[model samples]
Every structure is written in structure tokens, then in C-alpha cells.
Target: MPKTLLDVDGLTVRFEVKRGSGWGKKSYLYAVDDISFEVKQGETLSIVGESGSGKTTAALAVARLVPAHSGTVMLDDGNVLEKQGEDLRQTRQKVQFIFQDPYSSLNPRKRADSIVREPLDNLSEKSEDEKTTIVAELFEAVGLRPEQMKLFPHQFSGGQRQRIGIARALATQPELIICDEPVSALDVAVQAQILNLLRKLQREYNLTYLFISHDLGVVQHMSDAIAVMYMGKIVEHADRISLFTSPRHPYTQALLSAVPTVDRTQRAKQKRILIPGDPPDPINLPKGCRFANRCPIAEAQCSQTEPELKDVGQGHKVACHLV
Candidate 1:
């Protein structure tokens, strides 16, 4: 079995929101409310959810880009949250991020080569010649031409820019790459190319990815395991095949039902599961299950007590009263 590369436990991130007048009653918006999951070496674990589901916040917390209120993130057996100064800087090299918007992420002032080599320059003690050679190789690896390295970010199309972003993330030879909607900004045709490129690079470099996206179709294509989050908590987590074939949580079922399918048999077998009512206020969440109000088959007990995520069989875990 492949070793676990990243392990997150009790990760919680909160934002302070003041409602009333000056220094009024302060409330905490629990963005990521005590979620935990692990990604194995050389595999993708996707966290999928709708807008305001806190998937991005969770990813940001894992990378230490945002302050985690409380949690332990173990990356390659090292406690990421405990690292400081140079220690944290070194940790950054092992865990790089491919951001959502290629247009905004890249620097307009710098050339492609400099952008890609930035990580090597900052993180590693490589010679100038070595860095240059690495940048050239990275351009080739990510399917960019050698001559194009001199061009600015505005020179390339969206997809090409994303490839450059991927190259930058790979510059340090990272163990884990957090892809924050890596292909969402590209065209439909281009999205497939980038995703395939990422998968190819993963196989070539033995990279592990923590992919975050709201698109189930993209998640289905890229994920080895899937975790469904709603209102800052993971409602369900399972292997890709099991989650898609037999979703245990109501939220996961509703999510899968919305995915467009080409297969007629599969399409016919799926019924549209519409969740009614907006999610409860993050600052003042209900005491019971966060999804109880919206769940189709939620019982009286669902609103009285929160369900703990537990494995039914074959590593499939779900937090639901009626599962």
C-alpha cells in the first residue's frame, strides 16, 4: 500500500465578524470546522463542494496560506502548523500551490522563465546556470517552447499561463501540490488539456495532489478519493468509484445527481435531488447536524444530534443519521 503523504486532523479556521456598532458583539465564522482527511502518496484527494462550502479555506489552511484556528497538519510526518521562520520557508518548498486564476497569479512585470525559476531561486541553493537549465527543462516538461520563456505573462493564452503556473509549482520538486481550481479559468477544451497534463506530470514525478473544486465532473475525472464538504464540515468521504456509484450521505447524493452524464443507463438511474433552503449562517450554526434542515430524509433525531463520520464498510465514511 502507498504511504500516507499528508494527514490533516481537527483543522478549524475561523474569521471574526462583528455585526453591530463599533467593537460590537463579535462572532466567529467557522470557515473550516474541524475537518480531517489524508492523501496517500502519488494519488489525488479532491474536496468538492458548492460556493461558501469552505473548500478553498480548508486548502488554504492546509498550505498555511491562511491561519488555522486550531489543527494539526502533518506533511511527510512533519507538523506544518508548528514550523516557524526558516523551517516554514523550507516547508513551503515541499508543498507548493497552483492557484485558481492564471491571469492574476502570474506577475505582469516578469518573464516566464523568471516566474518558473522563482521557487528554485528562493527555496534551493542552486547555481545560476542550474536554475536557468531547470527553467528551460520545465518549459519543455510543461509543453511550453524554449523561446517562449522570454515572453511576459500577457503574451500567453490562459491555458499556457496555467502550464507556466504548474511549472513554477514543480520547480522545487514538491512532494505535495495543492491545486486550487487549477483549470476553472480556462476554456472547456483547454481544461481537459491542463487536467491531463497535471495527471501526466503526477505519474512522471510521483506527485500527490490535494485538488479543490466545486465541479463534480472535474472531481470525477481527477480524484482517487473524494471528500464532500458542506457548511465547513466533511459530510462524506469515500473512494472515487464508491462515492460515485453509491453515495452514502444525502449531500453527496444530491451533488452526484447534478453531474451531467452521457451514458443513457446511468442518466436514467439518477434522480435529481434538490436541497431546499440556504445553508445556515456560518456565524450562528445550529447545534445539531449542519445539513439537517436541507437533507431530504432527515429525521427528528437529525436535528437533535449531529452524526459522527464512521466507516460502514470498505473505507467509505459518512456523517448522516439515516445512512
Candidate 2:
């Protein structure tokens, strides 16, 4: 097996919210609560959950874009959060981000090439000619024409803009790319194209990816491993085949049941597990299992005691009372 490229242990990110009046006490919002996972070299580990599940927050914390309240994010030989000054700058080059919306991510005034070259200019010590050559190569790698590089982001279609964003992410030549809902903003057709392009780039560059998305279908297509999160905590994690075939967690089973299969026969008979109740507020989370309120298999013990993630079979890990 390839060496682990990124190791995140007991990662937690909390936001403080005000409660009442003048001397209000701070309430903690656990955007990412004690989540731990690893991304191996050249592997894609996807984090899938509902909107408030903290997948994106976990990604940002790993990238050091957000302040982590606890835990460690180690990339290769160094702890990313511990670094300062030049070391931090260098660490950032090793990990890049691809935002969700191509339209909002790119600058409207800058040409496509300039936008792609921005990372190179900031992180690289290369000369002007070298930067230009590298940017052109990235554009080609992302399937964008050299001539189109001169065009502004506004001139391109939604799909084309996304291609430019991909080009920009590649410009840094990062070892790990955090794709936070990268294809969620694009049309269904365009989503496939972007996913394919990401796969191709990963093969060519031996890149590791932390792909964050709520869409299970996309996660199935792009991920080597899947980590299911609920209410700021990881509920299940396993290899792609095991996750899809024999999901151990009730939450994972519910998510898979909701995915639309192409087989009409199977689709017609499949029973969808409808989870009741809205997600609890992060600022005022329950003391026990965060997912207990909505989990169908949750018992009384689930409401009083939190379940620690335990390896059940092979490398499959689950944090639930039933598991």
C-alpha cells in the first residue's frame, strides 16, 4: 500500500456564537467534531453528508484555511497547523483547493490564463517565461485551448469556467487537492466532464484528493474510500466497494437507499428510509451521539452515550450504537 500522505487525528473545529445580552456566554458550534481520517498517497478519500454535516469545514481545517480548535493535520513530514511564516507558505503549495462555484471563484476582470497563473505567481519562485509555460501546460492539461486563455471568465460557459478553475488548481502542482463540492454547481452533464477531468489529472500527477460532496453518486464515481459524516462527526468510513455493498451504519444505509439506481426493477422495489426530524443546531448539540435524534436504529443508550469509531471488519470503521 502507498504511504499515507495526509493524516488527520481527532480534528475539531468550533465556532463561538453569542447567546443573549451584554455579557453573553459563548456557545460552541461544532462544525467539525473530533473527526479523524487519513488520505493515502495518490488516493481519493471522499467525505459525504448533508449540508450541515461539517464535511467542508473538515476540508478547510485540513488545508489550514480555518482555525482548528484541536487535533493535528499532518502532511508528509510536517504538521500543517504548527508551521509559521515561510514553512506555512510552502505547506500551502502542497495542498490546494477547488471551490464549489466556478462563477464566483474566478475573478471576472482577469483573463483565464491570468487566473490560472495566479497561484504560480504567489507560490512559485520561477521566472516570467517559466510561469507562462507552466500555466499554458496546465490549461492544455485541463482541456482548455491556449487561445481561449486570453478570454475573461465571463466569456466562457459554466463548464468552460469550471475547466479554468481546474487549470488554476493544477497550476500549484499540489500533492493534495481539497475539492469542496467542486461539481455541485455545474449541470449534471458538466458534472461528469469535470469528474472525468479530475480523475485524469489524478492519474497523470499521482495526486491525493479530499473530495467533499453531498451527492453519493458523485462520491461513488470519484472516491477510493468513503467517509460518511453527520452533525459534525464521522459515522462510517470504509473502502468504496465495502461501503457501497455492505454499509454497516444505519445512516450510510439510508444515504445509499436514496441514491437512484438505473435498474428499473431494483429501483421500483427499493425502500427509501425516510429520516425524521431536522438536524439539531450545532451551537447547542446534544451530549450523546449527534446523529441519535435522526438515526432510525438509535436506542436509549444512543441518547445517553456517544459511540466511538471502532474498526468492525477489515478496515471498515463505524461510530454508532448498533454497529
The lDDT leader among the candidates is: 1
- Model 1, residue 32: displacement in angstroms? 0.2
Tens-digit lDDT track of model 1 for 144-199: 99999999999999999999999999999999999999998999999999999999
In candidate 1, stretches whose alpha carbon ends up further than 4 angstroms from where it belongs are none
What C-alpha lDDT values do all the predictions have?
Answer: 0.94, 0.91
Query: Residue pairs in steric clash, candidate 2?
Result: none
**lDDT, residue 46, candidate 2:** 99
Q: What 10-residue stretch in candidate 2 is worst by lDDT? A: 18-27
My TM-score estimates for the predictions, one after another, are: 0.98, 0.98
List where candidate 2 sits over 4 angstroms from the true fold: none
Cα lDDT of model 2 by residue, 54-133, tens digit: 99999999988899999999898788979998989888889999999998999999989999999889888989999999
**How far out, in Å, is residue 122 in model 2?**
0.7
Quote the positional error of residue 77 for candidate 1 in Å.
1.7
Q: What is the lDDT of candidate 1?
A: 0.94
